[model samples]
Target: MSEKFQKCVEDFQCLNCGQEVSGNGFTDHCPNCLYSKHVDINPGDRANNCRGILKPINIAPKKSGYTIFYKCLSCDLEITNKTAEQDDITNFLITLKNQ
Candidate 1:
């Protein structure tokens, strides 16, 4: 089966910080707290049933930009997302330092 790479633009409240986040077709994590919900198995496919709160654990420098690492608090699954333009750089730095 071929994976569909679709952009599922949807606004949702952050499960961790209760922040209202607006999705710009690619906005995955909350810009305020950098928290994301484990809703998609593929990039915006939303096929995953593990609806766990994705907690920001660390940040790593990527060639394109930076990637934020997340760990599912409920299921212990790890996920990574490339840093978004609207993401909080301050929080990203803090996460990088703590790593």
Candidate 2:
């Protein structure tokens, strides 16, 4: 299998905040709430079947951008995602504070 994260662009409703999120081909987390689902083992592969809610727990600065850390509420799995350009500033700040 190819070890690359696929670019799957699909809109999904935020399970945590109940927001109708529009996918931009690279959107993984909800822009309004910054919450993501534990759907993929790798970036857009969607091979994993955990299907848990990934809650934003912390943020860390990286060379390219900020990395948002998440902890799965159901499975206790930890994951990280890069900060998107369209991410909300207020939510980003709130994540930083909670880190």
TM-score of predicted structure 2: 0.80
Of candidate 2, the 10-residue stretch with the lowest lDDT total is 1-10
lDDT of 1 by residue, 21-92 (tens): 988888878997788988887877888878799988887888876788899987999988887887776865
TM-score for each predicted model, relative to the true structure:
0.80, 0.80
Report the backbone clash tally of model 1.
0
Residue-level lDDT of model 2, residues 8-85, one tens digit each, is 787899987888988887887888778998878888787777879998887778896678899999899999998788
Clash counts for all predictions: 0, 0
Residue 34 C-alpha lDDT in model 1: 86
**How much lDDT does each candidate structure score?**
0.81, 0.82
